[model samples]
Target: MILDFGDGFFLRQATVADHAALAMICLKTGDAGKDATGREDDPDLLGLVYTIPYQVLEPDLAFIVDGPAGACGYLLGAADTNSFNARLVSQWYPDLEARVADPGPDSSRWRGSDWLRHKIHHPDFAVPQALAAYPSHGHIDLLPQARGKGIGRQAMAFLEQRLAASGSTGLCLEVMPQNVHALNFYRTAGFKVLQDVGLPNRCIYVAKQLGFAPGVAG
Candidate 1:
């Protein structure tokens, strides 16, 4: 086991070379932070939806932690939510059509497959309320082994710093309302919480304004 201490793991910009490992991490971390290997026969679906887009479209914003074993965690996101969604519909989804399957009553399939089927046609976008304040949004996942020891915090800080540097007004991420651990982590990282507005799928959007010179009205 690679210890969390120095020299055991390191964070780096993600590249095509890390694609397979990143996909596996997406699958393993798919089930609300638990392994989704048993939940989906199509092991690649989760990664196809969540992990691969940023790799292809916005590589500079995506990062990964290399553990002694393999990829321990990653954070990836879009700098502009609206533009990213438009690109996903116009450029990305067409190529993925061949890989999709009809989401039927298959308890064996990953829930992400159903989402993939729907979003291919429906083209969902980020919450208007969220985008109004924070145009950039990110998604992160860390393997159980990667938790604690501040790796997640480092990864988050990396994104926050990068976004602030890029002149973003704010940044946001969708957290499950039930995932108290993730909520706490994000809160500690300086993100502000908004009351759950009863959205579908129970996603809670949290955000933080970038470069808020302290004590100034935001």
Candidate 2:
């Protein structure tokens, strides 16, 4: 275990065997930090797109949040966004595109998990120039049972330390503009909103500088 939160909650390195649990957690907290089970038809698609790839492609930075019941959350990161995006395009997306049919470009006719299906086929691997300074990126999600117990704070600190130890000078995360709680949490965690980035209307980028000492191995 990487961390023991006590009361039967802990953090551990995630493995491929935990894919199902990760998918369920992704679906449960999929809708802008709310449960999206009712809205998604193919519930696992969100995890396939967002969470699973981290464990498969960057295992060192992927971890699971386990409670008494089971895996309830995840912390995932990419130390280098450019390399990670390239790997996703070359090694990950082709297989996924073949497995999932495109839902087409028309949003009006889309339903259920159609949006995610479209994203799979037409994946965007671009990293905005504004985010170039923060070349590393991360994601963290916790179920309600794991929140309010200082888990999120500890998890973020853990991720930051990992990235810093790996020589990452900066780290960034994209949050939905509507998720006020997340935005606030990030701000409280020392992340600042990046201004003047030409991102889509849906995204808000928050970033922080990492203190990487020389000669440290991740």
Candidate 3:
């Protein structure tokens, strides 16, 4: 176990066996930090797209959040966003594209998991120039059972330390503008808003400098 949060909650390194649990957590908390089960037809798509790749390609930074009830959340990171995205495009997306059909560009006809299917076909790996300074990127999600107990804060700190230890100078996360709670949480944790006009309408990037000094261990 990586951390023991008490009350039967803890953090651990994620394994291939934990993929299903990670996907479930992603689906449950997929809708702007709320349950999105009702909106998804194929429950695994969200996890397949967002969570599993981290475990497969960047295993060192992938972690699971566990509670008394079993796996309830995850914390995933890529130490270098550009390289990670490149790997995804070259190594990951092709197999995924074959497994799922594109829902086409007609947004009006897309429903449930169709939007995710479309994303699979036309994957966007663009890194805005504004985010270039913060090359590391991360994702975190928790089920209701794991929320409101300081797990998120601790999990983030753990990720930050791991990144800094690996010589990363900064970390950034893309959040939905509507997720006010997440925005507030990140702000409280020392992240600052990065205004990037090139980002998609649904995205707001918040970043923190890792403050690692040369020749010093994080």
Candidate 4:
């Protein structure tokens, strides 16, 4: 599944073996301004989890970017609300619970934990409307070298095709509103702003119908 992007970059479906490297990318690129899961707070550990049995529990929607020995980027997803997000919560909750066991008022982990709890209890958790067809989209990241080469777009297009096969209407994800480039990228990709679901900061939720080709010019 390695896609030669020319100029030494490659795209491939990640495997259980690639978890550590992929996690490093996630850790290095996490939205430090806001890590809702508290998972991204530590990149190395996150990488370890990705390569382990955690993914064996859910495999259809995870991938990585490889360049050299280290992983440059990754894209992980879930198809249905019950399968993807649920497995994510099930896998991470205990660690979160442990971290918050005695988190004082000064603890960001405490706040993050509370936020996680709130979202899980929220109606969206009950039935994330976004999951209806496009219910399973998520973050995609690349190393600095990989930007603007259409790797992100290719990864997205790959995901959209997967969604379409599943009968999904579209794919959805959030981006920092201030990141003008990303906003424009999605718009060009035919994704419209669904809403602003930013919590700590203003990250807008955007979505695109699944069937359109990524050939659209923004």
Off by over 4 Å in 3: 212-218
Evaluated with lDDT, which candidate comes out highest?
A: 3
lDDT of 2 by residue, 1-218 (tens): 99998899999999999999889999999999999999999988999999999999999999999999899899999999999999999999999999889989999999999999999988788888877668899999999999888888899999999998888888999999988999999999999988874866678999998864355321
Report the candidate with higher TM-score, 2 versus 4.
Answer: 2
Give the TM-scores of the predictions, in the order they appear: 0.85, 0.95, 0.95, 0.70
- All candidates: CA RMSD (Å): 3.9, 3.3, 2.8, 5.9
Q: How would you order the candidates by lDDT, starting with the best?
A: 3, 2, 1, 4
Q: In model 4, where do residues sit more than 4 Å from their true spots?
A: 32-41, 45-56, 68-70, 99-102, 105-133, 196-202, 211-218
CA lDDT of each prediction against the hidden true structure: 0.77, 0.91, 0.92, 0.59
34-130 per-residue lDDT for model 3 (tens digits): 9899999999999999999999999999999999999998999999999999999998999999999988999999999999999999988888887
Pairing residues by index, what is the TM-score of model 1? 0.85
TM-score of 4: 0.70
lDDT of 4 at 40: 35
Local error of candidate 2 at 192, Å? 0.7
Tens digits of per-residue lDDT, candidate 4, 1-218, equal 55666666776777767766665565555543233234433345434433332355556667777665546767666566466556656675455445433334343555433433433233133444433445556667777767788888887777777778977656777687766777788888778876423322445777776654454322
**Model 1, 36-146: lDDT tens per residue?**
888776787678778888888899888888777878888897888888888887778887775675565554653745755655545566456534667788988988777
TM-score (C-alpha, index-matched) for candidate 2: 0.95
